[model samples]
Target: MTDALERALASLDVRAGSTRRHTLPAGGDIVLPAGSTTLVYLLSGEITGDLALGSGCEVDAPTGDGRPVSGRRTLLAGDAAMSLGCRRLVLSSQSGAEVIVVTAEITPSEIVASLPGTVLVTGFARLEPAAAALAGNLGPRPDGLACERPGDTVVCRSMIRSVLLSAVRAWASTGAWPAPIADPFLARVAAAVEADPGHDWTIDHLASLAAMSRTVFVERFRDAMGRSPAGYVTEVRIREAQRRLDAGASVSEVSRALGYASDEGFRRAFRRHTGIAPSAWRARALTA
Candidate 1:
């Protein structure tokens, strides 16, 4: 499932190479930002853990935020149903299982214009249909890498996109975006965020750009994607840093591009989220 979902994102325009795939021991908790939606495909075993809007925000998996997302006709056969405000999403891994996840902020502006559809709006978020569908199909890895299967990655990604395009058409025809996928305000904010990751960003600047009160922006941002404006910016910065790192940018150069207070600050945030120092991370990406 994880592989399928990752492939879905891989096929899309938003950071195909940016998707992070990792393996964790059972019962281990991993924190991910809500700046993007996640599609988890349980691999080698099933991972039964709480799905949350950030580490602390729990929306009741069975009946999230006064909404129910299970056993619905349009919802996938094995899919989950819940109100998905764009909070920085987090998932805990169950014992003896590895999960595949694709976390990203692929707004409608990034996709809707390209693919005309019902355009389900969510808070300040927009889940590009292709990416969302790929997230949905994170299982049955494709065929490419020489691991357990041949062309696993390639085949899985191709099939995942096929499913994603199909699901978008089906859901858009039904005329309503899913609860947790995305909403209106979220969409607008995504447009803004995608416009400039290099902005000298601040909560106030984001609040103004989002056209909301500071408190409102902060709360809504937290509720929708799980991270504060600053937090979301940090995530975006890291993504940018990864690109630079992959392209052979020095850590200090990346810090300047992402508007970090300093290179040290970027290093701290990068390590905290990815469990590796930036210098080391750059080496890995470049080497890989």
Candidate 2:
């Protein structure tokens, strides 16, 4: 499920990356001007803060908000509007604290659309024990090691993806994920598509799987997923192709495995979805 969410986000062009670590001294305040969407993960200590997003948006953390912030991890995810509005964002803590901020190069609306009802939109959530440990392990890593070398880029992406996936999964476990996955029919059909993107899927077949007529199924699916069934299937396939290519699979192999009639056919579809040929995308992805 996390993989599906990650792939969907990739197809939607939302790139997540770490920015910098911030430390707030005791009784200190840090004001930030408006900017992109940001995720702040508390690494240590306690803090309380408030934010004003332009005129109508405001986020408030009560005084001594993070007092006794032990064991579990505290996280705040929101756009610059909410975190740093037209005026500015202010952070203060009775005791000092350490936090890592990750900014995604997309607006709050885009993040909401891409992630649906996930925590990324709600702007706040707590990590469970295991998820907290995983996040803590990643908090100290350096940001933006240039991707000039394929190996280094892969490592950087892996780390970034791991943290993002952890965040998504934690929210998912809290039952805050979108309603589609909770629907029995949609869940079953989505599982089928993700499990085997190479499978030849038709509207009729998918409707049958969901025990619905074609007309009804198409309408329901689009309503729930925001895409036609066929379009969703194509997206999953492209994402699968991307994963395989990242793992060093050749174009021919990927094309055949994805059930494309020819390598050229796969190339064209890949370019349509990703804006580049498979070979070109692979080169850039390996070095981007």
Q: Write the per-residue lDDT of candidate 2 for residues 7-47, one digit (tens) a residue.
A: 54443333555556677788865554465544455666655
lDDT of each: 0.47, 0.57
- Model 2: worst 10 consecutive residues (lDDT sum): 63-72
Cα lDDT of model 1 by residue, 59-144, tens digit: 22222222222211121122321112244334455555444444322333212232221111121012234444455445434442
The C-alpha stretches of model 2 lying farther than 4 A from their native spots are: 1-18, 31-35, 51-90, 104-161, 178-187, 284-288
Model 2: lDDT to the true structure:
0.57
lDDT of 1: 0.47
Give the range of the ten consecutive residues with the poorest summed lDDT in model 1.
116-125
